[model samples]
Target chain A: MASKEKVAIIGSGLIGQSWAMIFVSAGYRVQMYDNQPEKVITAIKSIVDQLNNLESKKLLRGNLSASEQAALISGATTMSEVLQDVFWVQECVFEDVALKQKVFKHIDSMLKCDPILCSSTSFIPPSQFMGHIRHRSSALVNHPVNPPYFAPLTELVPSPWTKPEIVSRAKAILTEVGQKPIVVKKEVPGFIINRIQDAIFAEAYRLIEDDVVSVEDLDAVMSEGLGMRYAFTGPWETAHLNANGMTEYFEKYAQGIFDVQSTFKPVKKMEGPTAEKIIEAMNKKVPMETLNERRKWRDEMMIKLSQIKKSSQ
Target chain B: MASKEKVAIIGSGLIGQSWAMIFVSAGYRVQMYDNQPEKVITAIKSIVDQLNNLESKKLLRGNLSASEQAALISGATTMSEVLQDVFWVQECVFEDVALKQKVFKHIDSMLKCDPILCSSTSFIPPSQFMGHIRHRSSALVNHPVNPPYFAPLTELVPSPWTKPEIVSRAKAILTEVGQKPIVVKKEVPGFIINRIQDAIFAEAYRLIEDDVVSVEDLDAVMSEGLGMRYAFTGPWETAHLNANGMTEYFEKYAQGIFDVQSTFKPVKKMEGPTAEKIIEAMNKKVPMETLNERRKWRDEMMIKLSQIKKSSQ
Candidate 1:
C-alpha cells in the first residue's frame, strides 16, 4: 500500500469530493484542486461524512481512520500543483463547453508528463475540448455515475484521437482504485451509457406522453420486472440465455424486435404536454407537499440497495 | 401457509417446469398438466431437483420436503382437470399462433369462475386469442423471465378487454408466488421490457453497425458501467437523485438529454451488413468454441446473484 500511486481530482463539488473518497479508500494519495479555497478546506470534512455513512452501513471496503483519510488528501492551491507528479488527473470541472475548453487546455499545456486527464462531464465528448490541443493525447472523458462513491460504474470514453496506451493506463488505474471502468471505444454524443439511457427515456416519455400508463407503473415495469434481471444479466445476455442461445433467440425474435422498433415514435422535448404529464403524475405519486420527504425515501432506498449489493459481493 | 393458493400450470416444458417450481416453493398447490404422459409423471421429480438446487443455493424462501413437494403437485391429465379448483391458470404453450389460439380459446371457454387465466407468451397478446371468447375479461399475459425458477421478473400485460379485478388478482397471486410482476396498462407490442430492450438494441446495433465500437466494448459498457447503476436505481430516480434534488437535476441536464434525443436517427433492420456486424462482434467476444462453457458460467452466476438478492429481502 505504500507504493500507492498519486491521483489528482480537479473540482471540489459533489463529483470531485466523491472521487476523493473513493481514491483514498482504494489506497491512493489524492490531490484535490478547486478554485474556491473554502470548499477545498472542507473537502476533507465532506469526505469524512461520506466515509462515516459508508461505515455505518457496513459498505466501506477500504478500512480507513478519519486521520488516515485526511492524510491521503492534499488540496492544492493551483491546478498545476495538483497535476504535478500525479499518475492520473480526473477533471470534474463545470460541464460547459468553453469552461472545459479553457480549463483542460490549460492543464494540458502545463503537463510535463502525459498522465491521463479524464473529464467528469457526462454529455460532451473528449474531442469537443481536446480537438486542436497540443498534448491532447492524454485528455479523454471519464464519466462516472452520480454518487459514484457507492456505485462504482465508471465509463472511460476515449475520443478518436485518444491514444490506446492512455486508454489502457486509465483502465488499469481505475481498476486498481475499486472502480468498474468500461471503455467506450467510440465517443458518441452521450457515450454508451447515456445513449442507452436516452433510448430508455424515449419509451418512458412516449408512454407517459401518450397516456398509455402512469409514471409509477412505468417505473415499476422496470424495477419489479426488467430491472431485477438487468441487475445481473445485461440485455444481450438476457436474450442469449432466454430460449436457445443468442443466435436462436435472434432467429426467433429478430423480426419481432424490428417490428417493435418500427412502432417506436419518440416524444419531443419534455417541455409542454410531456413535462406536464410527468409532473402531474409525479405530483400525485409524490405531491409537492411532501416532495422533499419522498426524495429522501428514494435516496434511502438507493443506499439500502447499495448496501445489499455490497453484502452480495 | 395453510391458506396458500393453488396455481394450475398447463404444459410441462421448461417454462411450465419453472412455473411449477416457483409456485411450489412459494407455498402453493401446483397441478401440472401436459399431454405427454411421461412429462406429467416426471414433472414433480424435475421440480424437486430444481427446488433442491435453489435450496442448496439459499434462493428458496420456503423449504418443502420431498413428500410435501409431491403433495403440492396434484398431477392432472387434461385442461379441465387442472383447472377444477385452481385460483390461477398459467398457460405456457408452444409459440405457434394457431396452436395458441386454439388452446387459449378452449381454456377461456372452460374457465367457470373469474379466476385469472394468464399466458406466459412473449409476442402474442391476450386480444389475439381471447378477444372473442366468453371469459376474455379474466385472460391476460403474465410473461416471466426464462428459468422463472430463479429470475422472478414477470410482465403482467393486460389486454384492452381484460377486467381490472382480474389484473389485480393476477398481481396479488404473483406476489404470493414470489415473482415480481408489472402491469402494462396497454397491450403494446414487445410489452414494456422488450420494447425498451429493442430501443437500446437498435441504438447499440447502430453504434456497432456504424463501426463506433466493437461488440465486446459495447457489452462491457452495459455489463460493467451503466447496468450496474441500473441494478439499484431506475432512470427517473437516478435523474432525480443524481443532483441535490429532482428539480436541480432536471433543470441542470434535461437539455443535454433533449439535445441527444433530437439528433437520434432511425435504425435499419437487422439484415445483411447490420446482422453481420452483430454476429461478427458477438462471435469475437463469446466465440462458439466456448459457448457451452460460457452458458455454464452464466447459470452459476445467476444462481449466486439470485441467492444474494433473495437473501437481502
Candidate 2:
C-alpha cells in the first residue's frame, strides 16, 4: 500500500486545527506547529473531541473513522519539523499583515520543497503579505468560512505572481478534503463572500437607521424569507427560478430592482446611535455571556443544514 | 363552535391559491374570486392537490387535515360573493398599477364589511393604488414570499393613509396562519427583502463583471458558505455571535467593512453583456425546459430545510 501524503498546518488556532482535521479526514498526515507548544497540544485535543462529536452525530466528513483521522494529526514545536516533506503549508496565524509576512518569509527560508503556501486570512489579500516572500509563486490566500468543518466554502485567491498550477493544486486539495473552493481571479479586498455579505449588511444597517424596519423584523426578512432559498440556491439561480429564466426575470423586474438599488443610502460608518441600537437589540436576544452557547447552536444548525443539503443532492 | 372568519382571495393565480391554502389551514373560510370563473375553479383543484402533497410529505403547515383545509376553500364567481362578510381581502391580482387600481375600485364598490384590504403585489406600494379607495385606511400590502406554504414570510407594508390598527390586525391574522410577518414601518419600493436581495445581487454582478469570480463559483459562495449560517440566523444575530457582541464586532470590523463598502461601484443597469452572461450560465445549470422541475426540487429542499429548522428549534 502507498503511504499517505503530508500537509503542514502552522499556528494551531481554531482555523489551523480545522484545516488539520480536514486534511487528515482525507487521509493526509497533518503536522501542526505553534510558537507556544501548549497551544498546539490543546488544539489537537480539541480537534479530537470535535471529530468524536461529529462522528456521534453522523456528520463526520470523508470516509475515515474518528480514531483513524485523529491518529493522522500530530503537534510540532518547530516550523521546520512541520514543514518537512509536506506538499501543502497552511498559515493560520493572526490576521496582521506584518505578522503574516514574517511567518511566510520564515517558511520560505525553512522549506526544502516547493509546497503550496496558503493563508487562511479572511480579509487580507495575498499580494499584501506575499509580495516579499521568496516563494511568492506558491503563496496564495485560501480563506475559509468560520467553522470550516460545518460550512465548507473556501475562497482560493491567488496573487498576480502566484502560479496557476498552485491555485489548481490548492483547489484540488480543498475539494479532496470535502470543501467547495471558489477561485478569485483577481486580488480583491474581502474577496467574494465578505463583499456580498457587507453589501447585504450595509443595506440592512441603512434600513435600521432610516426606521424602515426594526432590527428583529429586518432579520426575519432574511432568515425567514430570502435566506431560506439562499441556503440551496444563489442569487443568479434564484432569479432564474423565480421567473421563467434569467432573461425573463430581468426583463420583468430589472427596472424595479434598479429603482430600489438607487434608493440605497450612501455607505455610512456602522457606528453612532444606529450601531448602538443594533447592539442593544442583538445583545437583548443573545446576551454577550451566551454568545458561545449561541455559536454552538449555530454550528449545530449548520451541520444539520449540511446534512439536509447532502441528502437532498 | 363559533363560525370561522372568512378571507376573500382576489385573482385566482398561484399567489392567490397559496393564500387560500394558508387561510384554510388556519381554519378560515376562503372565498377565491377571479374575472374568469374557470381560473378560480382550476386554482381550487391545484390548491387541493398541493395540500395533499404537502400532507403526504408531512410538511403541511397547520393542524388541520388536508381534507378539512380543502373543504374550507370555495370558488366565487363575482366580486360581491367573495367580498361578503369577510374580515380580510387579499388582492393577488396582476402586477400593474392601473389593473390593481381597477380591481381595488371594484372591490370597494362590492364590499359591505370593512375587511383588511391587502395587496399581494411584490413591487407596488399600497399608496399607488389604494389612495383612491373608500377603505383606504384599511388598505395595505401583504407581500408574501413565493411558495409561502414552505417558506412562510409575509411583508406587511402599509400606505400613509392606513390606520395603525389595520397593520396590527394584519399581523395578528398572518401570525395566526403560521406565517412570519415583518412590518415595514414606511412604504419603500421592493420593501425589505428585495432591497437586501438587490444589494447582494448587485455586488455579485460587479464581481463577475470585474472577472474576479465565475458565475457558478459566486453562487457557490452563498449556497455553500454565507447562506448556510444565514439560514438559521439573521445578519444582526450573526454579527453578535461572530464576535463578543455587536459592539465588539463593529469595533473590530467597522473600518474594514466601511472600506469594502466604499469600494462598491454605483449600482448600474443589470443589462447588456452581464445579463446575457448570467442568463447563459444559469440556463446551463438549470435549463428553461427544466425550470418547473428545478422549481419543484427547490420547493422540496425548502420543505426539508424548514423541517430541519423546526425540529432543531
Candidate 3:
C-alpha cells in the first residue's frame, strides 16, 4: 500500500497542534514546525496527551486508534524538513498581516512542490499576504474556528489569484479530515464566521450600552434561545422552519424584521463604562482565574455536542 | 394538598399549547381559552400527545408524570371562564396590534382579579396593546422562542406602565418552571431576543446579497462553527473565553471587530432576487413537502442538545 500522504503544520501553537491532530487522525503524517524547537517539542507531547484523553472518553476522531494517530505526528525544528514531501501546508501563525506576508514570502522561496498553502487566519484576507508568493495560485485562507477538532467549520477563502482547483483540493482534504468547509466567494475581512460573530457582538454592545438588558441576560438570549436552534440550523433554515417556508416567513415578518433592524444603534468601540460593566459581570460569572477551567468545560461541551450532532445525522 | 394555582392561556396556537404544557408540567392548573372552541379542544389533545411523546423519550420537562401534566390542562370557550380566579394570564394571541388591544380590553373588563397579564407576541411591545387596558399596570410581554418547550428562553418585556413587582413575580415563576428569562428594561420593537435575531438576519442577508456566501454555507458557519460554543455560552462569555478575558479580547480584536462592523451595509428590506435565490436554495435543502419532517428533526436535535447541556451542568 502507498504510504500515507504528508501535511505540514507551521506555528505549533494551540491551533497548529489541533490541525496536526486532525490530519494525523485521518492517517496523514503531520510534520509540525515552530520557530522555537522547544515549543514544537512541547506541542507534540501535548497533542499526544490530548489524543489519549479523547480516546479514553471515546471522543477521538477518525477510525484510527489514539496510538496510531499519535505516532503519525512528529515535530521538526527546520522549515525545509517540515515542508518536505507534503501535499498541504497549514500556516497557523499570528494574525498580523505583515508577519503573515513575511512568512508566506519565506515559504514561497523554499517550496519545491506546488502544494496547497492555506492560512488559518480568522480575519486577514489571503489577498493581503498571498500577493508576493511564488506559488500564489496554490495559496488561500483556510481559516478554522478555534479548537477546530471539536468545532469543524473551516472557511476556504481564495484570493483573486488563487487557482480554483486549489480551493477544491483544500476543501476535499479538509472534509476528508472531518471538517465542514464553507467557501467564501470573496476575500472579505473577518471572512464569514467572524463577520457573523462581530455582528452579534456589535448588537450585543449596543443592547448593553442602551441599558436594555444586563450582560448575563443578554448572553442568555443566545445560549437559552436562538443558540439552541442555531446549533442545528442556520438563520435562513431557522426562518424557513419557523414559518411555513422561507417565502411565507419573509412575507409575514419582513416588515417587522426590517423595522427592528432599523432600530439598531450605530456600532461603537467596546470601551467605557459599558466595557467596565461587562468585564465586571463576566469576571463575576467566570473569574479570570477560572478562565482556563471554563474553557475546558466549553471544549468538553463542544465535544459532547458534536457527538450528539453525529448521532443525529 | 392545596389546589394548584390557576393560570390562563388565552390562545390555542402552538405558542399557547407550549405555554400550557410548561405551566402544567410545573403543577399549575391551566385553563386554555380561544375564540374558536374547536381549536382549544384540538390543542389540548395535541398537548397531551406531545407530553406522552416527550415522556417516552425521557425528555419531559418537570417531575410530574405525563398523565398528571396532561390532566391539568383543560379547554375554556369563554374569556370569563379562563380568567376567573387565575393568578397569571399568558395572552398568546395573533401578532396584531389592534387584535391584541381588543383582547386585552375585553379581558381587562372581565377580570375580577388582577392577574399578571403577559402577551406572547414576539414582535409587538406591551405598550402597543396595553395602552388602553384598565389592567395596563399588570400587563407585559413574555415572548418565548419557537418550540418553547425545547428551547427554554423567554424575554420578559415590560411596558412603561408595568409594575416592578409584576416583573419580579413573572421572573420567579418562569425560573421555577425551568425556562430561562431575560428582562428588557425598556420597550423596544422585537424586545431582546428578536432584536438580536434580526441583527443576525440582517448580516446574513447582506452576505448572501453580496455573493460572499451561499445560503447553505452561511448556515454551516453557525451550525458547525460559532453555534457550537453559543449553545453553551452567550456572546459576551464567548468573547471572554476566546481571549485571556473580556479586557484582553477587546484589546486584541475590538479594532478588527469595529472595522468589520463599519463595513456592514445598511439594512435593506428582504425582497428582490436575493430572496428568490435563498428561497430556492432552502427549498432544495429542505423541500417544502418535507418541512414537517425537517422540523421534527430539528426539535429532536434540540431535545438531545438540551440533555447534553443539562448533563454538563
Q: Alpha-carbon error at B42 in model 2, in Å?
A: 1.4
lDDT of 3 by residue, A207-267 (tens): 8998999999999999999999999999999999999999999899998899999988899
**lDDT leaderboard ranking:** 3, 2, 1
Predicted candidate 2 versus true structure: per-residue lDDT over B36-116, tens digit per residue: 999998999999999999899887877888998898989888888899899999999899999999999999988899999
CA-lDDT, candidates in order: 0.73, 0.90, 0.91
- Writing each residue's lDDT as its tens digit, candidate 1 over B193-229 gives 7777788888877877767766666665565555655
| Poorest lDDT segment (10 consecutive residues) of candidate 3 chain B | B1-10
| Cα RMSD to the true fold for all candidates | 3.2, 1.4, 1.2
lDDT measured at residue A304 in model 3 versus the true structure, 0 to 100? 87
Rank the models by TM-score, top first: 3, 2, 1
What docking class should model 2 receive? Answer: high
True lDDT of residue A30, candidate 2:
89
Regions more than 4 Å wrong, model 3: A1-3, B1-3
lDDT of 2 by residue, A207-284 (tens): 999999999999898889888988889989989998889999989888888898998889998999999999999989
After superposition, the stretches of candidate 1 with alpha carbons farther than 4 Å from their true spots are A1-3, A63-69, A280-313, B1-5, B63-70, B109-114, B273-277, B280-313
Report how far off residue A39 is in candidate 1 (Å). 0.5
Docking class of 3: high
